[model samples]
Structures are given as C-alpha cells and as structure tokens.
Target: MSDLPPSVRRLADGLRRLPGIGARNAQRMAIAVLRAREGWPEELADAIRAARGNVRPCGRCGFFAEGDALCEICRDPKRDGAVLCVVETANDVLPIERAGVFRGRYHCLGGKLSPIHNVGPDDLAIGALLGRVRDEGPAEVVMALGTDVEGETTSLYIAQQLRSLSVRVTRPAMGLPMGGSLDVADALTLGRALQHRQDVGA
Candidate 1:
C-alpha cells in the first residue's frame, strides 16, 4: 500500500509471495507478526532458517528429508515396499497419508509434464523411479497424479515406460474431480478413491 511504511510493506510483500495469500491476508499477517508477543518474530525466523538449512529431498522418494537421511515413510519397515504411490509433488503425499488408506511407500515426481511450462521427464524423478522399479521390482504403482492435461500426459508417459515391466499400473478412481489435484482432495475422498482405484493397462 502506498500509505504504508517501507518496513511493513516489505513484510507484506514477502508474505504475499506465498501460495493462496492475497494482498489483504498479507497485510494482516504482517500486522500480526509485528504485534505478536516479544521474541515471537525471532522464534519464527529461527524456525524458518532451521528448516531451510536442514530439510532436503529424500534420496529414494524425493520427499522431504533431513540432510542425507531418508524420509520417515521411506525408512518405515512396516510400510509395503511392493506398492509405490507416485505423485506430482511432496505436498501431494500428505493428503494421501492423512487419508490412511495407502500403506505403501511414495515417489514424488517434483512436477508433471507441462510443455508450456517447459517441464519434461528429465526435469522430474522418472529416471530414478524406473531404476527403482527395475531394481526393487515393485508389484504395483499407483499414479496418484492430478487429472489435469499435464498430469494425464505425465501419467501416460510413465505408464508407457513401465509397460515393459511386470508390475501393474493403476490410477485413483473417478471419485476425484476430473481436473483436480491430490492436495485439494479431502481425506474421505482420497481414501475412497484409493480404495477403488482402476487399472491403467500398463
């Protein structure tokens, strides 16, 4: 805002850069941060700094990890290693985990194929996924990507690549919106979708 001081304006600008945060929300956040209890800002800054400095992608799954270690899901021996759930981003994993239906491990692709956006297979974790499938020989792979055009393209490409393998390929059922992302789906919807997944003919 033109009337706001430079410091507050800068804080609002930074907050506005976050997903789904608009101008009004950014201003409110800036005001809240400025008016918070003593030392709260320092604590928030420290937390952000620590997470940024320490968090890294899992070596196998591309999910969030700490330094060189694997993610919690990848390290869990109780999880089903024979089934891998593939998704567009690390954020997509949380909703499925919250749904509590899939006991399998995950593989984040970082992003889907988007020619307009210049995102291709090489830009994602497809190679690593193929290598894992070849080495580990998973029984199944669930393509839990979005139903958008880019997502469809990526899924088809992956399925084509995996066609030579013996594993079965499937996708979440029709309950999920035709063009929606996994992150926006509610737990109940995600659970139901996973429970009724359909074959991809891979």
Candidate 2:
C-alpha cells in the first residue's frame, strides 16, 4: 500500500467493508473525506456511530427502529393494519414506502431463503412474521420480494406457514423481471405492481 497515514488507511479499510464498495472506491472515498471541509469527517463519523448505537430491530415487524419496539411506520395509527406487505429487508421498505401506494403495515423477513448460502427459515424471522399475522389478523399479506429462486422459496414458505390462518397471501403481478430487486425499481412500476397484486395458493 502507499505511504498513507494509518487513519486514512483504516478509513479506507472500513469503507471497503460496505456492500458494492471496492478497494479503489474505498480509497477514493477516504481521499474525499480528507479533502472535505473541517469537521465533515467528524460529523460523518458521529452520524454513523450514533446510527449504529441507536438503531435496533423493531420487536413487531423486524424493521430498524430507534427503540426496542415498533418502528415509526408500524406505530402510525393512520396505516392500515388489516393489510401487511412482506419485504426481504429494511432497505426494501423505503422504496415501497416512497411509491406512496401502500398504506399498510410491513414485515421485514431480514433476507430470502438461499440454500447455497445456508440461509433457511430458521435464519430468518419467519416465526415473528407468523405471530404478527396471527395477532394483527391482516386481510392480506403481500409478498414484495425479488423474483429470484431464493425469493420464491421464501414466499412459498410464508404461504405454507400461513395456510391455516384466515388471512390471504398475495404477490405482485408479473411485471417485475426475474431476480430484480425492489430497491432499484421505479416508483411507477412498483405502484402499478402493488395495485395489481395476485393471490397465492396454500
């Protein structure tokens, strides 16, 4: 490595750990930080530290929350509790929310089922999801996961587990491409897909 200061090297190393950030991008980011105005890096560091310290999983929906209980969306009285949208991660929730088409609550599965990665039902918060469905008594659970094999497996698992429940389970219409992620989908496409969701069988 070049003769960069230890602090700069450490920052680059930390940045490299982030998803999609390679060594070159990490080095660029570290240099950018060094060139920033005074206190910028400190502010960024404080924000990252504070977020890590304060954020915790929502006890009800598995979304990130400031406390040990429900997230802001789950706690909102205006949101419809009768309909629940199931997503793969906390980040997936934002894009769906930004679509402004879904007014129901959400259940974050944390991740999809990937046999290759050894991520099974036990690895996810599936039990919590079933419990939420039982308690909330939602009319429908919308599977808003990607169209990949893992996503399909997860959706099927949820459907099977909830078969005994009175609530119906649905999925988005076949507009989204296979293996596509919701986070990168356009608002219009997501909104339309949500509006035309189809029912799933037990």
Best by lDDT: 1
Candidate 1, residues 44-63: lDDT per residue as tens digits?
Answer: 89999999999999999999
Which stretches of model 2 miss by more than 4 angstroms?
176-202
Each model's lDDT:
0.93, 0.90
What TM-score number comes out for model 1?
0.81
The alpha-carbon deviation from the true structure for residue 21 of candidate 2, after best TM-score superposition, in angstroms, is 2.9
For model 2, how does the per-residue alpha-carbon lDDT over 88-195 read when each residue is reduced to its tens digit? Answer: 999999999898999999999899999899898998989988888888899999999997788988999899999999889998776556699998888877887787
Clashing pairs in 2: none
Note each model's CA RMSD in angstroms. 6.7, 6.8
